[model samples]
Structures are given as structure tokens and as C-alpha cells.
Target: MKTSKIIIYDEPTVPEIQIKKLEKFLHDTFHADTEIRKNFFENREDEIFQEIATTRVFELKKPFSKHIPTKLEIQIEKENIDNSQNEEKILYDGFEFQKIISKFIPSNENDQEILNIIFTNKLTCTFDESDFRYHARALIGTNPAIISTTGIIEAPAKPKEYYLDLMVNFTKESAEKIKEKYKGEFLEYNDSRITEVVEGYLLQAVMYYETGEAFCEDRECRLYNAHWQKELLYTQSNKKLCKNHEESLRKIINHS
Candidate 1:
């Protein structure tokens, strides 16, 4: 493995992630020393909050033209309150947010071999020049990676029938009923299956940092890029990598 050690930062708001369990998962899977820390955003300088606020994406259809955030937005960033029940969804420019995080990392720990993975409730999206729009991403991989709990839930498409049923009569009461019909068909905010699903992302992040590839084309691989919730559920619950990835994993570990 390229990275000798991995340091994971916790996301306290979403306890379902089971970050501690994930720390163990990393050690067992990669044979790399894993360390867990408290929330990375806590006690950060005020300017960092201000900078983070600016990365918010207001227009999904447009390219990322840095948003000038309001005082309220900056305050909201500083507060970092639980957003589990938020009525309005907030999105951030993924790469820009990554840039801000890179700045906060200390020089000694900034090297390639000391990987840092940050878990956050924030939904991160990237602007696709080809599509000319932004799309939600669960993992933004690099030295200091971001694994978004919000993105894992919101990025993948829900059941087609569920959305189709929702479009027929979109009211609060009706939506509630529709959601009930497909309760177990897709992931909900507090789904117990979240921990297993997150393990897949952890694999992706570490592999991406070490191998320069974040995803696999194989459907059976945990590293497969899943666009739908069902695929995520199936691939993650299988709890096994494909033949090629398993081989690659071995080679990486052997070198380490």
C-alpha cells in the first residue's frame, strides 16, 4: 500500500456510520495502521468556516462559480448542527471543499503515506462539464478523502416506481404514503444497513489513494460504482471483492 497509515476523522452527527467499526474494518482489510480522531471541523479557525460556507452550491445546473455566502451561511457552517431533519438540502462543491480541507492539514501529516479520511454529513457534488450540471458524489478521494454520509443516501437513485408514484400526486401526505410503500426498497436516513454500505466506500477510498483507481467495472466488486440504491445494497452486503480486486488487494498488501 502507498499509505503506511490512515487517520480517520469522525462525523459525530451521524452515529449510524459507526466510524469506530470502520476503523477496524480498514485495519483488517488493508493491514495498515488505522487511527480514529474526533470531528475534524471542531475548533477550526473562523476563517475556515467562512471559507467552507463559500463552497456551497446554489445552482445545480450551472458550473461552480464560487458562491458568496451570507452571514447566516457562515454562522451555519460554524454551528455545524445536526442536519438530519433539515427541510432544505444544502450542497457543496466537492473539489473546492477538498481544497479547503487540504489547507488545514499540518505539513508533517500532509505527505502521501499518511492518508486522512474525513467523514462528514455534508453532501458533496461535482460539476460535470460534459453534463453541464452537478451530481452528488459519495466519495471524493485523494490524500485527505471525504466520505459523505449525506451523499451515500442522496446520491444513488431511489426506486423508479417510487419516484413514478411520487410524481402522480406530490403532496406531503401522499409522499409519506409513497415512502411507506417503498420503505425497505431504498436506504432511509437512519437505516441500520448504513454501516455495511460505508465499508464499501472505505475500500474505495483506500484503493483510490493507493492504486489511483477508485472504482471497478465489475458489478460483483465492492468497488463498483453504483448509481442506484439497490445496486449499493446488493454489492455492499455481499461483503466480497471481485477476483481481480482481490488479487490487486493482495499485491498492494504484499508490497506494504
Candidate 2:
């Protein structure tokens, strides 16, 4: 199997102060002992790169030639919430807990078979789709309940940062290589919390794909559309724009 380099870019448009604060928060929260670096353009003509964050390098194994593994199944055991008669505490208060529950290339209808390889902090040795199939069958044979979400909560709280974007650049071969190597065992062996990281990446990617824009300081702002008008008035903000400005901006955006 061949491996390829994948680069994921996160461009955030936050105020300088807020960006610094966020960087500090992430570093402290994750206990990541790395310094955040800013890239500035010297040319006065160019717009400054607002904010940039990169993911640690991930080497993916390819299982097939056409598609890359976009999702994974991992075991998530929630800590017991204290819902006693005296106390009703909400777990992870004020924090939206979103995760990439399961992601795969989806070779077949048997989504259940993929559950067997989902072990905690264990990375499976490299294998291909065929290997995943075999391992999945073995898992089903031993424990049939692995696929069922008996205690897992499907839809959890939404995160505070509702808008996100992700740009993943990788060759098809590299993605397949990653899947091939860790088909059934990727989540189990990897020590890092794969669920949260993957979810964040996916959220970013989806936001970028859907909106065709980057994150902004104003979380409420949507690219090329006036979010204020939409929220303030019950109409598409762009449509509600003043006739002259609307026509001029439309012409500029359309032509440019």
C-alpha cells in the first residue's frame, strides 16, 4: 500500500484578540505544548491571512483506488451524569458535544460489521478492505451487540462555534492506503481521542463545502449573504437589500 501527504487547512476570520484567546484555550485545554505561529504577508497589497491552524500529520492507508475513508466508528463511553433527586447536573455544561460518530468509505450495507474494530486507544495493524471484512466477521461472531447503540446518545448538544470549515487535500491513493492499513482497527490503537478530532475536521469541511467561505469573527455572518437581514427580517437578506446596492454588489460578485 502507498501513503500520501494530506493537508487540512483551517482559516478562521476572528479578531486578533479573540484568535489569541482561542489559541491559548486550545493549547491549555488539550495540554498541547506547541506554540501557535502566525503567517503574515509582507506585501501591503495582499490581504493578510486572518488566522490559520493546521492538523498534525496523519498518514492514511489506502484500501481501494477510488474513495478515501471519511468516517470511522469508535467507542465513546459517557461519564455517568448525576441525576439524583438532590442534584440534576448537566454534563459538559455550556459546551456543545459533537463528534464524528462513524465514518467509512461504505463498501457495503453491513455497517454493523465495522463495529468490531472499534477499540479504545488501540491502533490496528495496517490492512485492506478484505482484511476489514474478515476482522468484522470475527467481531460479530464473538460479540453481536457491538453495532447497537444501547447507551450512546446520537444527537448531543450543538457546539458554541456553529460555523466551521475544512479543506482536505489528499490523493485518492493515500486515503485508500490509510483505510487499508487500519480498516477495522484504526480507532482502537490510536491513543489520541479520534472522535473529537475527526468530528471537528468533518464539521469544518462541511461548513466550508456548504458555505464556500471561511470562518468569520462574526459567527453570525455568512459569506456573500447578509445574515443580519435574514434574522432581523423573515426574508433572504440578499433579496431584502436596497435595490441600488444590491444590483451593484450582485454585478461585482457575479463578474469578479
Candidate 3:
């Protein structure tokens, strides 16, 4: 492993993430020292909040253009609030958000040996060149990787049948009923399965830093890049690396 230690920045709003349990999972799985820290956005500078506010994506179909944030938006950024608690969704450019987080790291602790993973309730998204549109991403893989708890629920596509059912005579109340009907099929806010799903993302971050590969093609693999909610649940809940990833993991650990 290129990283000697792993540090996780917690998202306190979502207690279902179970940060301490996640720390234990890392130690038991990788045999590495893991540390947990408080929320990353807390106590940040006014300028930092201004910078973060500019990363929000208002137009999904278009590529990223730096947003000129309103005073209210900047103020919203400054406020220490659980963003997920609100019904409205806010989107941030994942790479831009990662860059902001990278700058926030203390220089003394910023090094190859230290792997920093930030857990955020904000939805992080990336613009796809092929589709020419922004798409929510659960993990933004890098030195300071971001695991967006909101993205975990929103990124993956829900069941096709559910959407089909929703499209027919859809009303706000009807949509609520549809969501209730298929509640357990996909991750909801405050889902207990978040901790398990996050473990997969954490491993992907570590493996990306160590081996330069962040994802696998196999759905059975914990590192699989899942586009659908069912696949995400299946891959993460299994909690086992595929043969190739298992071998790669062993090699990385042994050689470290």
C-alpha cells in the first residue's frame, strides 16, 4: 500500500454511516491504522465557503462553468447544517469539491503516506463528455477522495419498473406512495446499509491510491462501478473483493 495510514472525515448528520464501525472495518480488512475526524466543512474560512459555493452546478445538461454564487448561497455554505435533511437537492462538481478539500488539508499531514477520505452529505457530480451532461457520483477517487452520502442514494438509477409506474399519472402524493412501495429496493435517506456500502467506496479509494485503479468491471467485485441501485446494493453488501482485486490487495499489502 502506498498509504501508511487512512484518515476518515465523518458526516455527522448521517449517523447511519457509523464512522467508528467503518474505522474498525478498515483495520480488520486491510490491517492498517485508521483515524476518524469530525466534519470537514466545520470552522472553515468565509473565503472557503465562497469558493465552495462557486462549485455548485445549476445546469445538469451543460458542462461546468464557475457559478457566481449568491450571498444566500455563500451563507448557506457557511452554515453548519445537514444538507441532506432538506428536500431540495444541491449539486457540486465532484472534482472541484475534491480540489477544495485538498487545499483544506493541513500541509504537515499532506503526504503520500496519509490517505484522507471525506464523507459528505452533499451530492457530488461529474459532467460526462459522452452524454454532455452532469451525473451524480458516489465516489470521487484521488489522494483526498470524497464519498458523497447523497450521491450514494441519488447517483444510481432506481428500478425501471418503479419509474415506469411513477410516470403513469404521477402526482406528488403518488410519487411518495411509489417511493414507499419500493423503499427497501434502493437506498433511502438514513439507510442503515450506508455503512456497508461506504466500506466498498473506502476500499476503492485506497486501491486507487495504491494501484492506480479505482474500479472493476465485475459487478460481483466490491470495486464495481455500479450504475443502478440494485447493483450497488449487491456489490457492496457482498463485501468481498473479486479474485483479481483480492490478489491485487494482497500484493499491495505484502509489498507495503
Candidate 4:
């Protein structure tokens, strides 16, 4: 409730996002001004894309090292910025990508009370020093929070048996059959259930902005950091916050 307004930048490639519905969701939840915009990466200069391309993560286990992008890579960046749907599965260092994006935000609008949440099809990942590896993150919290639709699908692990089956029978056809066998057990590309899953992430972003806390330990909470596909669906099944978070949200709104 500390936020006076939320400006959401859409990811046009993913039509399942349905920006208008998400806008309504935020307005209804917080009684705050909600506005939707086109993808933030659109219409950016070539140099900006070059800078963003430099944030690409190559060695997943190693820490970030600034990448010197190839001409082809830069061209791909431009195409992606133009809202082309032919995006390759490129990995980007999420925090470094966020810093690049922050530079493009209008200086006047860069204030604490206006939450800028960006939605993207790109996979946003962070290198964990403790684990010494990269991990996909659905929501990177803060003023300009990023919700990666790809991350939502890819970050959470699928059922163990599915992986075990694929590990043994590893042809493309077999893999496709394995995925088909576990179809409804996890989120897939172009899944309609993304709308509900995304709502949870948006809630997490707002909660983080308001309280400086982005997650709940309870699997029943929408703010719970889900590591598995089953957990993600279970947490989002009812689309309700846990009792304590609900109370905190009420207090914030009331005080506002």
C-alpha cells in the first residue's frame, strides 16, 4: 500500500499474460492506480541492446563476466526488442540485466512510490555464490521488478519420475512422449494456467515493495518461493495469501 501506482510493462510474445486482466487484479487487490505499457525492451537503441547482450550468462556455474557479444548476437537482440517471437533460449544474468533496464527508465518516474514491474519472455537467472551455480528466478524483486514468464515455466523442477523416464529413454520422440505423459503436472510453454501463476508473482512483487520481504515459508501462501512444479500449482491453486500475509496486506492498505 506504500505504492501509489504500479506500471506494468508487457511481454507481447506471451499472449497468455492478458495484461488487462492483470491490471484489474492489481487494482482490485490494492486499490492503487494500475497502468499497462508495451514491452520495456521495445524501441530501445542498438547500443542499449548491445549493453543488455553483454549481461548474457555463458558459464552457468561461474560468476558473471561481461560478455563481448558477436554481431549476430547483437542482431538477435534487436529482433527481440522489436517484439519478434523468434527468440532463442538465451540466458541473462538477472541483476545485471535489471541494472541495464533501470538506466532506460525515465529519470522523473524513478521514485519509490511508483512500482515498475516488467514482464518478459526471457529467462532471468542469478548466480548463487553459496551453491556456485546459476538458478532461474521468476521474480527479481525491487522498484523495477522483473517477472520472467520463461522462468515460471523452467525454474521449477518437474516430477522426479518424469526426469527419470527421460534420463533412461532419451530420444527426441521419447522425450516428447515423456513430456506428454506428465503434461498437466507442470507448466508448459503457451499454457493458459500462466495467468493464474503470474498473479502469484505479481503479488510477491507488491508485497516485496511494501514490506521489503518477498516470500513466505508456508507452501500454502501465494508468496511462497516454489521450487517444484507441484508446489507452484499447489500454492497458486486457490490464489489466496496466507493468514499472516493477508493481515499484513490489510494493515498496509488501512495505513495507506
Candidate 5:
């Protein structure tokens, strides 16, 4: 493997992401030394929080521009609030947030062979020029990878029928009923299955760092880039990679 070490920062607000299980999973998968840290933003200076708050995405239809954050916004970051659990969601520009985070990483640990992966409950989004809109992304690929727990639940499209039901009902109660009807079909906040679902994303980050490819086209593979909730559930259910990726994994380890 190209990566010799991986440093994972935890999101304590989301207890479903058990840090030790993730640590063990990476060790078993790659035999790479792993270390866990508390939330990356924890104990950061007030300016760091204010700077990060400036990266918030207010207009999903437009490209990123620096936001003059409200006092509440900076306070939210300082408190390490998990807004993903609330109905009113907050979005941040993924790339911009990554840039701010990169500035905080120590100079000594800035090696290509050491992967730094951060887990957060914040929703991270990227602007797509093709669509001219910002879209939520579950994982952002790079040296210091970001895994958004909120994005994992919200990014993928839900069942079509669920939306159709809401369209016809058009009431809060009806929406809740519809959600309950399709509950198991998709992930929700604080879902127990998140622990299992996150493993697939971890595999994606690791494989991307090693091979320069972040996803598989095959739906049966764990590394498949799933755009829909059902696709995510199905691909992760397989609990394995495609034959080609399996071979690639062998080569990655062998060459190392």
C-alpha cells in the first residue's frame, strides 16, 4: 500500500462511529499502523472556528463565496454541535473546509505516505459547475480525506415512492408517515447501521489513496459510488470488492 500510516479523527457527537472498531478495521484491511484522535476542531483557537464558519454554504444554487458568519455560526462550531440531527441542516463547502483543516495539520506530518482521515457530523458539499449547484458529498478524496456522516445519510437519493407520497400528502404528519413507511429502505440520523455503513466509505478512502481511483463501477462492490440509498445499502451488503479490485488490492500490498 502507498500509505504507511493513517490518522483518524473522531466525531464524538455521533457515537455510532466507534473509533476502535474503525481502527481495527483499517488494521485488518491494510496492516497499516493506525492512530485515533479526538475531534480535529476540538480545542482549536476561536479564530479557527470563525474561519471555518466562513466556509458555510448558504446558497446551494450558487458557487462558493466567503460567508460573513453570524455569531451563532461561530458559536456552533466552537460548541461542536451536531446539526445533522436537526431538521434545519447546515452545509459547508467541502473543498474550502478541507483547505482550512489542512492549515491546522502539523508541518511534520505532511507526508504523502501518511493518510489523515477526518470524520464529522457536518454536511460537506461540493459545487458542480456542470449542474451549477452545490451537491452534498459523502466523502472527499485526497491526502487528508473527509468523511461526512451527515452526507452519507443525506447525499444519496431516497426512494422515489417516498417523495411521491410526500408530494401527495403535503403535511408534516404525512411526511413522517411516509418516512416511517420507507424507514428501513434508507439511513437516518443515529441509525445503528451507520457503524457498518461507514466501513465501506473507509475502504473507499484507503483505496483511493493507494490507487488514485476512489470508486468502482460495479454495483456489487463495496467501493461502488452509490448515488441512491438502495444502491448504497446493496453494495455495502456484499461486504466485498469486485474481482478486479481484489487483484488490485493484492498488487498494492505486494508492491509495498
Candidate 6:
């Protein structure tokens, strides 16, 4: 006879807005009266095989997004192995379960502005847990997205025991994109400071357009700003070149 063991570790912080969104997703996807119960783990016991899932939402302040992003993490542990092949079978089945859950999330919206503004932008997503090991540093776009699980599976022949640890992250990016797409669209900005700020932002946008890079560090830059924005000059003593000159030097150095 063979025996298997599964262990899951979860440590997530969810915000209120994303919690509601996740609940809606669950209700819509599963058609189940899914109520996200808090403090549900207080009754859990050790060495008992169980399936556990948790959801969390977080709001990132601007330069990122006004609306918060939602995250869901799930863990499933099972025991009792009867054969040598049971370990492989469990891993395959676990991945299949992850796939099914991934399909339940939403997709990016069809709106062009929304897609261009949000879906095209990239965001960082992270996955790290002790029991399981699959983790990635970043992901692109949003709206019902699935982050792959990571971790190790150990099956010892002599001990006749199998251990599987897995972690998966799900996010809703589409709705957040839609909300940000048109935010402040109709708001009037008559203040001179606001206008100047807008102009500066436009200047940065133009720089990005001409060079295929951002003027600031908010996003990746294909070319340095010094080379791209010749009109402005600021020196970096470390590089012994002004910002404009530094970027130009970078181009020169790269070309050479």
C-alpha cells in the first residue's frame, strides 16, 4: 500500500474592494453561494487532509492604479497513497485542477482605449510559499488572470510517502483597466499648476512616442532620456554627463 501527503501554506492580505470583486467572480463562475469566510482556519487541525482556499484584494496608490487589484490563492492537500504511480497521478491532477480554475476568471475587455491604456501595460505579480515552490516576478495586463503554481513534489520510496505543495495566484485586471481608462476624463482642470502638470506629462508622453521609451523610470526605456530629450539637460556626476548627454552617450556606446 502507498500513502500520500499534501501540505499548503497561505499568507495573503486582501483589501475590501477586491474581496467583493472575488466574491462576485466566485458567484458568477461557480454559481455557488460563495461567502468568503474570515477566520475560518482557526478550527483546522494538523495531519488532516483538507482542501483550503483563500482570497485577498489590495489597493495600490497612484503611479500604479487608483483601483485595487484582486488576488485569490488556493491550496489542496490529500493523503493516502496506494501505489507507486500515485505520486505522478496526483501532480497531473493538481495541474488540471489549476487549469479549470484559471478558466473561470474573466478576460480583458474589448474596448480599445481600455486595452491600449491598461491591458498593454505590465504589472508585477509574485508567488512565494514555503510548502510549494512555483513563483514568478511579474505578469502583464489584467482581468481574470491566472498565475501558475510553483513548488516541489517529494515521494520517498522507502518511506512510501508522497508530498505535494502548490500555490496559485488569480487576479482580475479587466475591470480595473476599464475604471482607470476614463478616470478624470471629464473633470475640468483650470488651475495653472494642473495645466503645467498636464503639459509636462504630455511632454513625457511625446518623448516616449518619439523614442519608444518613457521619459521617467515608470516604465522600461529603450533609450536614455538625455539622448531622446535634447532640450533638457541635467548632469549625473557618477556618469559625468547630463541626463540628455548621458542617454546620447549610451546610444553612442551601444552603437560602437
- Which 10 residues in a row give candidate 6 its minimum summed lDDT? 1-10
Evaluate candidate 6 by giving its C-alpha RMSD to the native, one decimal: 23.4
- lDDT (Cα atoms) of all candidates against the true structure: 0.89, 0.22, 0.88, 0.88, 0.88, 0.24
The digit string of per-residue lDDT tens for model 1 on 128-202 reads: 989899999999999799988889999999999999998898999999999999998788888889999999999
Residue-level lDDT tens digits of model 5 in 175-197: 88899999899999888888788
For residue 65, model 6's alpha carbon misses the true position, in angstroms, by 12
Per-residue CA lDDT of model 2 for 90-203, tens digit only, reads 111000011111222124412422211111111111223554421101001111011111111111211222112111425676655554554432222232332332222222
C-alpha lDDT of residue 245 in model 3? 93
Clashing pairs in 4: none
Worst 10 residues of 3 by lDDT: 79-88
Tens digits of per-residue lDDT, candidate 4, 230-249, equal 99998998787889999999
Stretches off by above 4 angstroms in model 6 are 1-58, 61-190, 216-256
Model 1, global lDDT? 0.89
Please, what is the TM-score per model? 0.97, 0.15, 0.96, 0.96, 0.95, 0.17
Per-prediction tally of clashes: 0, 23, 0, 0, 0, 17
Model 3: CA > 4 A from native: none
- Clashing pairs for predicted structure model 1, backbone only: none
Task: Give the winner by TM-score: 3 or 6.
Answer: 3
Which parts of model 1 are misplaced by more than 4 Å? 85-87
Compared with the true structure, what per-residue lDDT tens digits does model 6 show for residues 74-155? 2232222211112222221222223332342224422211111111001122223453332221111121121111110111
Candidate 4's C-alpha runs over 4 A off are 82-87
Misplaced by over 4 Å in model 2 are 1-13, 40-256
